[model samples]
Target: MEALNLLESFVRSAEAGSFSAAARRLGITPAAVSKNVARLESQLGVRLFQRSTRQVTLTDSGEQFFQQVSGPFSTLRDAFASASQDAGKPAGVLKVSLALAFGREYLVPLLGEFLARYPAIVPDWHFENRPVDLIQDGFDAAIGGGIELTEGVVARELVNTHIIVTASPAYMKGRPVPAHPDDLAVLDGIVRRSGPTGRLRAYTLRNQAGDEAQVAQCTRMVFDDPEAMAHAAMLGYGVALLPTTHAAKWLESGALMRLLPGWHADNGPVSVYYPSKKLLPPKTRVFIDFVVDAFRDREFAARFGAP
Candidate 1:
């Protein structure tokens, strides 16, 4: 329908940040894209964007509407793309970004099987330690721990990840292992500097009454890399807070011992996020579904030693 076309055009314009860019991508004139978006605004009874000669930005209402409509629109697009596939083959470039450590430990191994299954799909993988802007950077998808999705992105929770306090056997040799969170203040601790904030590592601990209390202030060494922190902890640096997934193999090998087991912080979930598009390419949909199925299997917990 014309309304649907207008909606698609508006979304593309907003994403591209310019009618000219949208026009080129859509294979239409810039004026046509502008008119289509104007028609969309009229029908919606709200000005979705504020435009000037220099820039185009979404209005507050536009941002809200985009968040609600983007996912459904992307789903509908994926459905259409799935129906239109020829010879039962999916073809397209799937650009994905992921954190370095998580990507190396989990996604890299999983991607080999994925690539083998979808030979027609070309995947471009970017591994970084920091978050990248999905729309601005032109990434189709991302796999990361945090769910800090932008306005026009959709996130699917894949797994629940927990943080554990850990230290090497040498570090625990002389000192009594911390039995509770509050006891951490007296023990040596290695801090991660690149977390949500560049501050001391604070963890959730339980008090004597079995209620949760926050232990916000005890640190001896700070490191930017979590792997470094783990290594430092292994060398008897101090207790380090790490994701359970990252520390699982080390724990199993007796290289690292979990400290204050009852006081570990429960981080919400790990998710795959992608920009909302009118038609999600078949490859992206299949990959997302595959990730969901792979993570939700009961054996996944046993394999990862998730608690």
Candidate 2:
């Protein structure tokens, strides 16, 4: 009945991408949701969503309006809940998306412990390499590198996901040890393809001293997953640039040797991303904190890279 109610319906519908979903969330009918949105659109003298049989998408102006209003509206809701002390127990499905290798090697081990701490929470997690649209997909959180920060999402740093150049010891037995980053251009390179963009990743190396060198990687073999690429390097395929966190285990077992140890590619921080600060559910909030605390200290440091 109120203008704010109409706007709330509009925001929920836009983010959910359908009137029926918004109605389900609001405990109303799809017709009611449509009417509220239509009334709001008439008052504003602008179309907010382009309705289709498949999905509802925002117009350009509606996108801008959502950006401006969503954060504050979420904050208002949070404030009301806090005032009423109704931000109660965190229960229900806590859906998460994570990188395949990182989830397998790191997050999976901690799941039992996390569930023990929050028995009310149900773990609904997906492991994949590509970036996930947290808001659109209705996930509580997603973790890994190369997370593009969108308006309704935020990233908390989990670890520095820097990369190192490495190769199998057998591959280096007869070859001249690279004295500098440039010498690696002569060695065979096993490269990785970008999961998000599907382009071959280039070798870009940097050191603590801030010197930078980039090589247009010539691929002897190509793989999409980092763990797979690391396996290729360990089998004496060629020198490969890999995330130290991912490569640390093989390097420790002497399956691979860090080459030009001083040089590394500063890719980016592995971050745990969530919906937004204002509307952060307790399930999402605690999980984010749990992950950061788990990895921030020494999990990957002594063998992996500088913490």
| Each model's lDDT | 0.77, 0.82
Candidate 2 lDDT over residue span 182-220, tens digit each: 887789988888866889888678777888898655668
Query: After superposing candidate 2, which stretches have Cα over 4 Å from the reference?
Result: 1-12, 19-52, 57-89, 216-218, 301-303
Q: Number of backbone collisions per candidate, in order?
A: 0, 0
Residue pairs in clash, model 2: none
Candidate 1 clash figure, as a count:
0
Per-candidate TM equals 0.71, 0.75
Model 1, 1-307: lDDT tens digits are: 5766787778777778888877765678989999998888898899999999865789999889888886676576567667767676886778889878877887777877888888888888899877777776667789887747778789998777777788999989989877667777888878877565776655675433568867654679888777788788888988888877778778888999987765556756778898777677778888888787877863445544333
The per-prediction CA RMSD against the true structure, in angstroms, equals: 6.1, 4.9
**Which candidate gets the maximum lDDT versus the true structure?**
2
TM-score of 1: 0.71
